[model samples]
Target: MSVEATGETRSVVTAATIREILVERAGVDPDVFTGNELLSLAELQIDSLAVLELQAVLVERFGVEIPDESVTMTVGEIAAVANEDR
Candidate 1:
């Protein structure tokens, strides 16, 4: 979603947005992403199927390409990469 920054507006790809996509599209638990902790997908209990789904949603929503080697990346890291691509 678009967020208002100080005199400069930008699109923000937040962890909450990722969590919502996981919950709504991938059937992940809402409680699983309770904080802004930087944890890997495995640490967040995301499975292989969920990872693929997450990647698809990221591409569709942000038009950002996440490399396959990023399986160990945290949500925050992924968001940072996506934001950079914006």
Candidate 2:
């Protein structure tokens, strides 16, 4: 997503980025992630440990944090948190 600046927009972590992270860092099967960005981690059967692991990757890659240990969040939600934290 992009944040409106003075006269320009700044890009931030997006659902697509989160999807990539989930796929690469969290070992989320690409076939499973093909569902939708709105699908919750729980619905995808992503474990809490993977959630924490994803958070670490977020911090290292995007310099952002999701604020809490929540595996029930969707990629869109995680991206929203990353955008806000950034």
Candidate 3:
């Protein structure tokens, strides 16, 4: 379901959305993610190629354009940014 379809009543921020994307794409163990935790690509073993894949997924899934400035963000930070954009 799309984020809106979740019927959560509260708005989902870009940071949260990005966090969800990471969780799904990285196969991150749920217990390890708080959606507000600092996420390190190196720690997660995510490579440059994987980052590109993530960019594609975020665009496709959320229809939000990710800018170059966003590349420096951690997973949680990205979601927060996304929330602001939406």
Candidate 4:
């Protein structure tokens, strides 16, 4: 296991990329993620398990760790977490 093999070589994590990961990997609606990035995942009825899966993808895909309180974080907040690590 190398970092490149784990897909952690990406230089950045953008909102669009996060949105794509949400839609493609986390089962979130494409349209849902676009509006009110301040709203928490719970507000959108996105379950904690889904968020955990999303967090996993963020690490495997971007090498960023989601906070333990991730389910309470908004989409923008989630992106910030990744960007912060970068």
Top candidate, metric lDDT: 4
Clashes of each: 0, 0, 8, 0
State the number of backbone clashes in model 3. Answer: 8
Better candidate number, 2 or 3, judged by lDDT: 2
On TM-score, the stronger of 2 and 4 is 4
Write candidate 1's Cα lDDT for 1-86 as tens digits.
43444455545888777778779999988887777367787888788788788889988876777767555888777777767845
Better candidate number, 1 or 2, judged by TM-score: 2
Ranking by TM-score: 4, 2, 1, 3
What is the Cα-based lDDT of residue 5 in candidate 3? 85
The residue-level lDDT of candidate 2 at 16 comes to 82
Query: What C-alpha root-mean-square deviation, in Å, does candidate 2 show against the real structure?
Result: 4.4
What does candidate 3 score in Cα RMSD to the true structure? 6.1
lDDT over C-alpha atoms for residue 43 of model 3? 56
lDDT of each: 0.75, 0.77, 0.59, 0.78
| Candidate with better lDDT, 2 vs 4 | 4
TM-score of each model, paired residue for residue: 0.75, 0.76, 0.52, 0.77
Q: Give residue 32's error in model 4 in angstroms.
A: 1.7
Clashing pairs in 2: none
Instruction: Compare candidates 2 and 3 on TM-score and give the better one.
Output: 2
Which candidate ranks first by TM-score, i.e. highest? Answer: 4
**Model 4 local distance difference test score:** 0.78
